[model samples]
Target: MKNCTLDLLGIKDSRLQFDPKYKNKVTTDDFYNHRKARFIHLLQSYPCFCPVCGKKMKRNGFKTVEMVGLPSGGLTNIFSIRKQKYLCPSSAACPKTITKLAEVQDVKANARISQAVKYQAVSKLGQNISQKYIATDFCISSMTVMRFAQGVSTYLKPNQHYLPQNIAFDDFKSGNFSQSGMSIIVMDIATHRTLDIVRSRQNTYLRSYFLQYDRQARWAVQTVTVDLYSPYRAFIHDVFPNALIIADRFHVITQAYRALNQVRIQAMKQAGHGSHNSRALKHYWKLLTKDSAHLDFKHYHKSRNFRNLQLCEQDIVERLLAMSADLRLAYNYYQTLLQAVHQGNPALLEELTQSAAGLPDPVKKTNRTLRKHRQEIKNSFETTFSNGPIEGTNNKIKTIKKTAYGFRNFENFRLRILVELKNSYVSLNFHSA
Candidate 1:
């Protein structure tokens, strides 16, 4: 029976069976060395051919190199490698000699960490995790982790994809540093992806970027939405003549609300020192611009004295709040006007003109701006285009800022944004399946 079992085990070949320990003895070090040898063999299979001559390289020899690895708490694996060098037949023309062995998996030729480790490092970039913590976890030096991060960054730079049919532009102040704090973000509105970010929103910078695109690429853009910034208006008109420029609804409302706030503040300042009225005005300040019907009865009671202030301040504040309701009504009417225009109703123009007349002074100004750019605004409504994606991306930028204690270098900040966007695109594609 034992003979039969042995025969069965050796069915493929008539080899004799032996005790597992006696058959082959291998240590942990031996296995590690074998693994390293296999990795080197795999690399050799894809020879680092000479760029000039395209010839297979020969191993020159081994070189002892010291490189930073994981932090003190982690073990650093320092090992020697066989270097390769290729000799070109034409010594005079070929600047060829012995080539150093290819460092398998390592991002930098002589670096201690591998490309896999570098990629892992990039994944943690901009995360709140400290360099020291990463070093300890990976058993490499902090400097090594940093170098790996830099290597990953270099590899990703060339592969960045920035293709978009429609893009939106907007700017936000970095902080209280006046224009110094302002940075502009250009985004692909359709895909909700950021296209580019610049330190300034100046026309000259935008013009250069616009001109970088060929005529065909420039013409591909159907429309662009931005705020009432005159610089953007001039630049888009000059660069993308075929593209329509629509003022975003959010920008329009933001501007209107800003103006309303200005009026409110001015009115409060002019109200002078009437304790009762000033207190009342202060109490109902937020409620003033909100829908009156949405306000609780207590707010109305608190603000009753504000209604008794001098005619101009009272009238303006009341009028401003009234216009909130009018704005809503106008917004609905505008939607109808949009539908009518799209349907090519003959009386649509007349209806829009009438609607314009019904708007309050502030709203009338906004409508006039729309009318002057009527074709663009109308096209915007007709198409499913908006800067909503860009707005959403802005929140992401803020998150990145918060995650990292705050980036001092705009270049690094921009690169981090690009990396995050690429990662997000990859993640979305993966999850969508």
Candidate 2:
């Protein structure tokens, strides 16, 4: 036995010993008690100093044994920590005393799971997994998961310049009819990112937000594309005087088509069954709305009877598309309208009224609305920009909504969107940390 040391059993280390009596005697209780001391030793190895005071601390004693780990979601280990308290030496003046190391893991010392675990849970499951399922996976209560998710949400912070230069404004229904909720969204056109979102479509709210911005930011906006909402027009003029406003081509076309649909439906109702024109109208409805180039010959043949209605709709669509082109002097007039409105040229109003008179009732009505808010529409074309980015961002937001089922609490939803938006910009190298 040269330099042999004794092991825990007080036996010489050299011996390869085995006892038959010890085989059946070992039990769970024996193993647990044996590991308890080792677990405490492991905890002591990682000492926590007061973040504010920068002072070394000693354990006063075990305060309480708490379940302070994420429920084992089959992915991570669950922890039940025996919280130990430490008291600082300068207790009289020092604000915090008797701090607990377990607080790092547990959001609150008494919480059943650690904050890290909760975050992991959210990252892993998101909205796809139900709260009940999360609880079962983690072997924790659903309330714990909910609390953990909330705790993680507190860290998201909104940044400055959240709104982009070119933006899109749109309204979406937040809730069902009677309890109807409405939200107005602004998106960055270039990146298709949501720049800002407001819970209400109220003009006052829009005006207030713009009023808060300094003149430089207000003027920095190049273009805003939106539907023909009168209040939106008013707010845009009051806030972004220098910016161009674009009546989104999509919105204009959709509105026109919707009106055509109404007309078709009415016509159908008046016509008796088996009428050639009625059947023709039904067959040509799709052809009328669809681009002819995209339609197959079979569908074109089917629509032959309703050629006049289709021609009417097609002519309107083609004119609108041509308005977007540089060749048409109409585009020039469109841009001039905004400039004249901004310069307070009374002649521009008369010109717009004349233009309004030549159009069909639907186009005339739309033109009238545009004339009423001439300044805003003029601003749109003059601005030469659209909220394309913001619209793109809204699509992403919708995706997020769909992925998460739907969020009941708007605040949480808002925070999540903001955080995700910031994260996206950061990823694109467009944002500073």
Candidate 3:
């Protein structure tokens, strides 16, 4: 019976014996008003010597400690253990009578919750679920769950002495937890592991933060992939002198993509509202932006906007481009820019951006923006690194905030992200108190 009880509770300590008086009795408690499986145990372990005098100690009766444990069989389990008390005899070395109570294994002294329950709480915190749900599941307060988070965060802290050779920089909306309403995420490009999260994305803050690492570690960084943010480029130059900046290809292509769409919208306006040509411009805008090489010129289908005329994807795009001269110019430049990026040809990109005359204002503006970051854009073509992984991380951060409805404290928010993202692993032996 004792072995079965010990096995049921997952207790490994042999000194804790189950009391037979309350056998087979599970009751509800008035305090929690929930079904609870209660058990009485006696701690039979005793210390041979007193700590202060190093002399034999005598038993001083027993003291019962009530402890909350992990749920079992859909009911909260509470252990009422009678701890054997010890008393040191008065002597010259130790004049006063000192008493100590035996402590249960896998539980802290004077703590009401068992270490196993805290370990379970820590594991649950690694998931995307919020603290309120975890607290309700474990029948504990949200503050206790936060304490568990704080405990696990100690092991998740990034090492200040190390920096990867290739890193990616990006920022995400961190709510009001940060001073700037944004936070920076530094990621390792090779492993896709998040290196750290900075509370603020300000230049001075980032400069001081990266300067904490050793100069050799900083110098070892070979390349940095970042968005088209100009301040980021300047910051990289000041901190990582040897690091080559690679402007993310996605952001670069986005400039051209938006400009082309703007020109298409202009074509729709010029074609007159409620007209078939305007409707065609609006409906077939996707075909205009799609790769010309992918268009199916062989397959013909009846068009809704062209009086039942049979048109293939290629024909539809050509007709749409014929709406205005500016549209045609912008479409040609957009397609060429897409081809250049796909082929990783920096020279074509340079020539295209340098000679952007007679195009729409939007496309011209995109060209100027591309010219400003010409060198970094060139490095992007030469390097295989991009901000794809970091952008995915940002999406995850946004999802986390969405699920939790946002957090009030920045440190807690950061810790929850680090834990959920698997940035660090927690061990059961760690103390949460």
Candidate 1 displacement at residue 215 in angstroms: 1.8
lDDT values for all models:
0.53, 0.52, 0.81
Q: Give per-residue CA lDDT, model 3, range 359-431, as digits (tens).
A: 8999999999989998888898887899998888898888889888888888888777777776322222233
Candidate 2 ranges beyond 4 A from true positions: 1-64, 68-76, 82-111, 122-163, 176-180, 293-360, 370-408, 419-433
What are the per-residue Cα lDDT tens digits for candidate 2 across 100-202?
4534322554455545556666554444455666665655666666665565443443244334677677877654311337777666665665555666777
lDDT of 3: 0.81
CA lDDT, candidate 3, residue 353 = 80
| Poorly placed runs, candidate 3 (over 4 Å) | 30-48, 423-433
Candidate 1's residue-wise lDDT over 77-138, tens digit each?
32223333444444554665534444443446655554455556656654656565665555
Better of 1 and 3 by TM-score: 3
The numbered model that scores best in TM-score is 3
Stretches off by above 4 angstroms in model 1 are: 1-108, 126-163, 174-180, 291-380, 402-408, 422-433
Task: Please name the candidate that would achieve the greatest lDDT relative to the true structure.
Answer: 3
Model 2: lDDT equals 0.52
